[model samples]
Target: MKFYDFGDIIASDTEFVIFGIPWDYLSSKDNVNSSTAPQKIREVTKDLALTTEMGVEIPSLKVVDIGDVSIDPTNIERNLREIKDFLIAIYNQKKDVIPVMIGGDHFCTFPVVKTISKEFIADDNIGVLIFDAHLDLYDKWDKGVYSHATVSHRIYDLDQFNKNNLLIVGTRDIDIPEMKIANEKGINHFDAFLFSDLGFKNLSKDIVAFFQNSRIKSLYVSIDIDVLDPSIAPGTGYAIPGGLSYRELWQLLRLLAKNFKIIGCDIVEVSPNLDAPNKMTSNLAAKLLIEFISFISN
Candidate 1:
C-alpha cells in the first residue's frame, strides 16, 4: 500500500510523498477539482513498483503518497499559514526526503514555495524550476499580491530565491511585455514552440547543463500541468496548444530524476471540470506521478 487519507502519516518514510493541497478556489478563474487531483493520481500510481508501463523503476528509494494538507476553504490567510506550517514541520523532519504535491491552484504555490524556501533560514538562496506555459509574473498588487497570476512574484519579493536560481520552461503563449521582462531579467524561460523548432533533444541537454552549473544547493519544481499540450492534457484550468507531449515532458522527468536534487514539486491547474472521455489531463498527471515515483524509487 502506497497511500491513504490525510492525517494518517506517523513518520515520513518515503523519499517522496503526495502533499496534496485541495484549495482550488485561489485561481484567478477559480477552477474546482484540480484541488482533488492528488487523490485521483495516487489511486493509479500506488500499485506499481520496480517498473512502469512508461519505463523502469528507480532503485533504493521508497516513494509513498502521504495524502494532503487539509485547507480551510473559508479563509485564505489561515489556509496559507496552515499549509506553510504543515510543510515546515514535514520539511524540518526530513532532510533528504523530497515533497511532491498535487495542487489546489497556482496561488497555493505561494505557501509551498514559502516553506521550501525555509531551507533558506540558514542560506537565503534556492533555485526554482517552473514547468508551465504561463509567465505567472504578471504585475503585482493590482489584486494586492493575492492572486494566482502574481504568486511567483510574491515568492521572489520574499528574497529567498534569486534570478540565477530561477528556470521556466515551455512558455509558448506569453505576452510581449512578459517576454521582455523574463528575458531582460535573466529568467531561464524556454518557449515551447521555439524549443520544438530548435529540437527538444538539444533543449534537454541544455536543461541538464543548466542544473549542473547552478550555484544553489537545492531546488523546488513547480509544474502547471498546462505545460502539456491540450491534446494530451485537456483537464487543466489553462491549456495551450503547441505544448510538450507527455513523452517530451517525460524526457525531462528522466533527466531531472538523475541530475537535480529537487527538494519539492507540485502539479497544478488540473480542473476535473474539464474531464473528457479519456480524462486525458488527469490521466497524464497520474502518469507523471508514476514517473516521479519511478525515478525516486531509484
Candidate 2:
C-alpha cells in the first residue's frame, strides 16, 4: 500500500516523498516489531485524503512513495550504510523535496538526519525537533552502540547536526546519563509536565518564538509515537503514562508548520505488536501524517 495513494506517482518537482525503512534491529531489549509500522500506517491511510474533523483543507500537493528499504537485520553496519545511500540518492534527486519517513524504530532517524546534514544541508546548521517519551541519548544501551537508545548521541557526533539547535519535546522519561548529556550539550527539553503547566496557548507561543529566534532555517522533525499518552498511542515500545494528548500534539505541529520551514519529518516506533485490537496507534499515526501534510500545505 502507498501513502496517500492519490494518483499517478510523480517523482519530479515533488512536495514530499514517503520512504519506509522496515527493520527494527536496534530497539532496546523488547522484541517489539516496529518494522511492521510502515505498512500498517500505509494500510490505514492509503485511501485517505480529506480531513474528517479538523476542517482544514489541504491544497493539492505532489507526493511520492519510494517504498521500503530492504535490510538484513543481522548486519547493522551494512544496513545503516544502505539506508544512508538510499537517502543520499533521494535528496540528490531534488533540491527541496521533503522526505517523510515512516520508521522501523527510532534508530532509523540517525541515518536520515546524518544523510541530510552531510549531503544536502552541509553548509547550514540543521535543527532537529524530536517528540518522544525518552531522550534516546544513551552512549550505549544493553552494550549496543547503534541501538535506538543512542540515536541522539550518534546524531550529535555528526558534524552537520547543531547541538544547540537540537530540541527534544514531549519527553517524560530520561535516565541520569541521558539527562546529563542533554544538559551538557545545551539541548532544549520540553517535557510533558512543563507543557501542561504552561498550558497549550502559552507553550505554543513560547515554542513558536523560540524557533523563530533560533539560527536554524531548515529543520527535521522526528516523532516517536510513545510521545503520546498510552490511551491515545499504546503501540510503541515504551508507553509512558503522562504524554501529549492527540489534540496537544496536533496543536504543536500546527504551530511549528506555521512558524518554521520543516524540511523533512519521520514518525517512528509505531509497533503494531503492542497496539490495541482497534489499532488506534496506527490509525492515529496515519492521521498525524495527513494532518502534517495539510498543515504544511497552508
Listed in order, each prediction's TM-score against the native is: 0.86, 0.93
lDDT scores for all predictions? 0.71, 0.82
Q: Evaluate residue 168 in candidate 2 and report its C-alpha lDDT on the 0 to 100 scale.
A: 83
Rate residue 221 of model 1 by lDDT: 79
- Compose the digit string of candidate 1's lDDT tens values, residues 1-298: 2432223453555567567888776676744577777666555454335456554644333655566787877587899888877777775766566777788778888788887776433544467888889888766534456767776666666666656677788987777766776767776677787666778888888876675576665667788988988888888777789888898888787787777666778888888778675566667786776676676454
Query: Candidate 1 at 180: error in angstroms?
Result: 4.3
Off by over 4 Å in 1: 1-13, 30-32, 43-50, 54-61, 120-125, 141-143
Residue-by-residue lDDT tens digits, candidate 2, 12-71: 667887888998879884669999899998887755666534776433556778888888
lDDT of 1: 0.71
Clashes of 1: 4
Position 196, candidate 2: lDDT? 70
